[model samples]
Target: MKNIFKFWKKYSFVLLIAFITLSLFDLRFALAAVICMAAPVFSAVFKGRFWCGNLCPRGNFYDNVVAKFSRKKKVPEFLKSYLFRVLVLVLMMTVFILGIKQNWGDLYGIGLVFYRMIVITTIIGIVMSFVYNHRTWCHFCPMGTISSLVSKSRKNKHVLNVSADCVSCKICERQCSLGIIPYEYKGELLNHADCIQCGKCAVVCPKNAIGYKST
Candidate 1:
């Protein structure tokens, strides 16, 4: 299971690119797109934004394509705020709903809507890649926002946690693509609303202090 997840984390982008390429000629891609889009909802219920961390094509795109050329600037303070994150999510959903309504009841029209959404998102990813750290757009993604909310509401589950060995080195903070400061939450489950459960904190901890614990 661990190796399977590692493989997905490493090569999921290739799958994403292949799916996008196939979507150009096949309607089956639309169904795949729907499933991909809905995956976060289900995965979040069990594992926070694990889908974003491991399987999201958009995230994979940022990791593989944008990060290589990214300027890696610190993300703006406003973009990390809950208010701003929710607002961006609302705006994106509004646009999606309006687009669907405008093309109501036609399969081809719906497919075009999904296609255009992907194109626009790719453009946003390109622009964000040049301006900020890789996965900056993810900080404000609607699906991610929703997943985080669900994860926050759940309790008594195994979640990422920090231990007493933490020395406040801040290495985990730097490793976090979403800007969470794990060491700051030492001795407790790191349940920040934006935590995607990516496990980078665990991977980067020199003391080997961070891991999942029932909380």
Candidate 2:
């Protein structure tokens, strides 16, 4: 299981690129992007962002970018890491409410608003990933924000800390592109709204103290 997970994590970026290319060539293939939209739904039922951790192309790109740069910035610990979650909720509520009221059936809907929103949000997500921490966009990402919320509600949800095996080496925290303090989280496992489950923490962990499991 571990080997399979590692292999998927290593190659996820390549696969995501292929999916994007196929989506461009074939409209039907656009469903590939839905994987990002749908992955959290699956995680909600299963209790982990399995796709985000091991399959998301965007996640892979952001992780690499943050890992390459941003090592100098220090993240202050805070209890309300859900700031990202709040932004996502506001955006979604605005879009869905406004979109429904405006009624996309109007000719102006797709061109003026829908397409513009999509383009602007996409740019924001990509640019933020490069400029800020990895998966930083996930905090405000409508898709991820929704997923994180749903994934935490499952009856079987569990956070596997295994921190006893951890050595207080800040590697996991430092390498975490999402800015989560792996050592500071005292839960049995991480169920936070900000966790994109990119698995970089686990990868960087020297003692392999952090990992996830569903109850």
Candidate 3:
């Protein structure tokens, strides 16, 4: 099961392509967008931003496309601010709502909205890749924002922690795509709302100090 999960995480971009193709050619598959939209919420209840870390097609885009071609740059402090994230979320949701209302119960229209969303996100991901470090758009993704909120609400579940063996080396910080300073929070259960549970910190820790633990 774990290997299957890793495989899915590694190749999730294929699902994104498949989704786009289905949306363009078969209206019946339009409902997949709805399922994708709701998946973050459901997954967050159990594993906190697991969907973002392992199942998000957008994250796959960053990993496969953006990271391959872009220069690494530090994300701006302003862009990482919670207020900016909320504003971006509001704007995205407003656009999404307007698109839904414009489509109004038609499968083709719904599919078109999903299609446009994928295109727009892809473009944004490409643009952001050139301008910022890995997965910078994730900081402001509306679905990610919502998932973070849900994870925060259910703080006791699926928490990551650090052990006393931590050397205070900042490798985890460097490994973190979201800019979280894991060493600083060592020895404490991490429930940071923005934590995507990507496990890069845990994987890179030389002492294997960081890991998941139930609270």
What TM-score do all the candidates reach, one by one? Answer: 0.91, 0.68, 0.92
Per-residue lDDT of model 3, residues 1-215, tens digit only: 99987877777888878877776778657567777779988888888887787788768768876688776788888988879989988988888889889988887787777778767876787798788875888887778888888888887457678877789988899878788888877778766877888888999999989888633
| Model 2 misplaced regions, further than 4 Å | 1-4, 15-26, 64-84, 90-120, 155-159, 212-215
Colliding pairs, model 1 = none
Cα lDDT tens digits for candidate 1, 1-215: 98997777777878767766877887446546677678987888877777887688778778767789988788888987779989988888898899789978877677777877776777787798798888888887778888878887874255688988899999898888787899988898887767777787899899989998643
**132 Cα displacement, candidate 3 (Å):** 0.5
lDDT of 1: 0.79
- Kindly give the stretch of ten consecutive residues in candidate 1 with the minimal lDDT sum: 27-36
The residue pairs found clashing in candidate 2 are 159-188, 159-189, 160-188, 160-189, 161-188
Which is the leading candidate under TM-score?
3
Which run of 10 residues does model 3 get worst, by summed lDDT? 27-36
**TM-score: the better of candidates 1 and 2:** 1
Model 3 misplacement above 4 A:
none
What is the C-alpha lDDT profile of model 2 across 64-137, one tens digit per residue? 54446533343333312567457666877687558647855654442344334444565565655455544555
